[model samples]
Target: MRFRPLRSTPTSSPTLAMVAEPPADMRAVVIDRTGPPEVLHEASSPVPRPVMTELLVRVVAAGINPIDAKTRSGKGLSQAIAGYPAVLGFDFSGVVVQSPYESHPFPAGTEVFGMLPFPRTGGSYAEYAVVPTLSVARKPTSLSHVEAAGVPLAALTAWGLVVETAHAHEGQRMLIHAGSGGVGHFAVQLANYFGAHVTATGSARNASWLRELGATTVIDYTSTRFEDVVADVDVVIDLVGNVHSDTGTRSLGVIRPGGLYIVVPTHSFPGYAEAAAEAGVRTTGYRVVPDGSALATVGRLLDSGAIQVFVDRVFDLAEAADAHALLEEGHTRGKIVLRVSDD
Candidate 1:
């Protein structure tokens, strides 16, 4: 799908009259109960109102993440679901239709993208979403809403892992597993951008692409064990926990003594901390929280072409189930996004 580019970031939009108020109801992808991807269905729901520094947005697209699928399948944030027929989404990109106030910087029609407060309010799956102001930022002008939609949660997580957690910098050596995934891909780029020598593990097909994204070494996990070829890294960002292939445990062997091991999927291996301690490595689990400031900074990097977000596929909103299904296949190079509406 083609998209109309946003004019610029932090602009005083003149199109405020076009979006004075939202409609009474809106289309949404809701799950009657947590089960599987097939449970996601289209339904009409009331338009949520923006209260207390919130913005009502006309959703142009929504990004599908691993957590969305997990929560849909009765894991991840599923335990926190308040009620049935629940909307499930976190990342979104669109235009503001209702501002916090008349003088708010983000007047109606200003383009933006960010994450929703899932569990608290997993409402980004709808046509219009009420988002807290601090949880969103202006959409990168260089990207379409679909691309912008794929950013927020995944990129923020990567930023936190590579920049905040690992403190990636020159003279550092980092190993990232599942290097082609939504967060892993960004982690690879950010680690490299910060001058870390990055070694990544992905499939053979993604090896060259991962290299192009700044992976100094791309280990094809299919043929060889990453622990065999890589060792003594300053940090190990394991997106693939032991759930699939004992990846988290195997990663402990590759990190240098006292180096950090960051587990993105915390529950994938609950005993990981104990294992890492035995291996003489520091370990911690990381979870992403909404941060508009961090997202805005990522936007600048994207606009400057310092980094890029890969959208592996796009599905219409009604095909949300199909999107989630594809996401679970675990081979997606980057992100899968739902085309919720036009820009």
Candidate 2:
């Protein structure tokens, strides 16, 4: 599906209208009960209003992260969304329809994209959303709405781990597992940008692509063990979670003493942290929180050609079920986005 790009120049803005109020109900992807993808229902919900520190945005597109589907399957949802009827999505791009204050960075009609507050609302899979002002930023001018929609969650997760948490600096060596996955791909580029020598692990077919994305070394995890290939690494960013605990444990062996190993998946293994400690390395388990400032930082990088956005696939909003199915296969190259109509 094709999308109309948001005009990013000062004189060029999106041609969206401003009305006194929106309709009482709007279309949304609602999970009435947590089960499978088939249980997801499309229904009408109230058009959310902008409260203090919030902006009401008309969603042009929403990005699908693997965790969104995971949480929907009764795996990640907590008491925050324990009720049956729930909205599921975190990353989105759209026009700011209204804001609580006039001094808002995103005034009415500003084009923006970022990760919304998760668990508490998870309402980005809708025609409109009420998001905190600090949780969003001006959308990148170089990308279309659908492409920009793909940036928030996965990209930020990669950035926060490589740049913020691990502080992977120049002349350092790092290894990233699952180099072709959403977060893995970004982690590769970001690490390289920080002047680090990056080694990444993926299938044989993805090795060339990973190199093009700035991976100094690419390992086909299918044929060889990455730990056996890389040694004395400064950092290891593991995105495969507990499902690959052994790989995470082995990652510590590659990092030198006092280096860092950061885990990006849900649960942290008891032995993984202990092994890192035993090896005289630091270990951290992270969960991403919404950060608009980071989005602005990323937007500037994108605008200056410092970073690139990787979109593995685009699905229409109605084909959300198919998108989730593809992501569940565990081999998506980059990010998957759901394109919504301007009407």
The numbered model that scores best in TM-score is: 1
User: Local distance difference test, per candidate?
Assistant: 0.91, 0.83
Residue 299's C-alpha lDDT in candidate 1?
Answer: 98
Residue-wise C-alpha lDDT for candidate 2, range 141-190, written one tens digit per residue: 98888888988888888889988898878998989999899888888999
**Residue 198 of candidate 1: its Cα lDDT?**
97
Q: Candidate 2: deviation at residue 287, Å?
A: 1.8
Name the weakest run of 10 consecutive residues (lDDT summed) in model 1.
12-21
Tens digits of lDDT, candidate 1, 1-343? 9999888678775555347657899999999998979999999999987778888899999999999999999998888999988999999999999886767878887999999987787568889988999999999999999999999999999999999999999989999999999998899999999999999999999999999999999999999998888989999999988887799888899899999999988589888888999999999999897999999999999999999999999999999999999999898989999999877
TM-score of each: 0.94, 0.91
Error of 1 at 70 (Å): 0.6
Cα error, residue 333 of model 1, in Å, equals 0.8
> Alpha carbon lDDT of residue 283, candidate 1?
91
Q: Cα RMSDs of all predictions?
A: 8.1, 8.6
**Number of colliding residue pairs in model 2:** 0
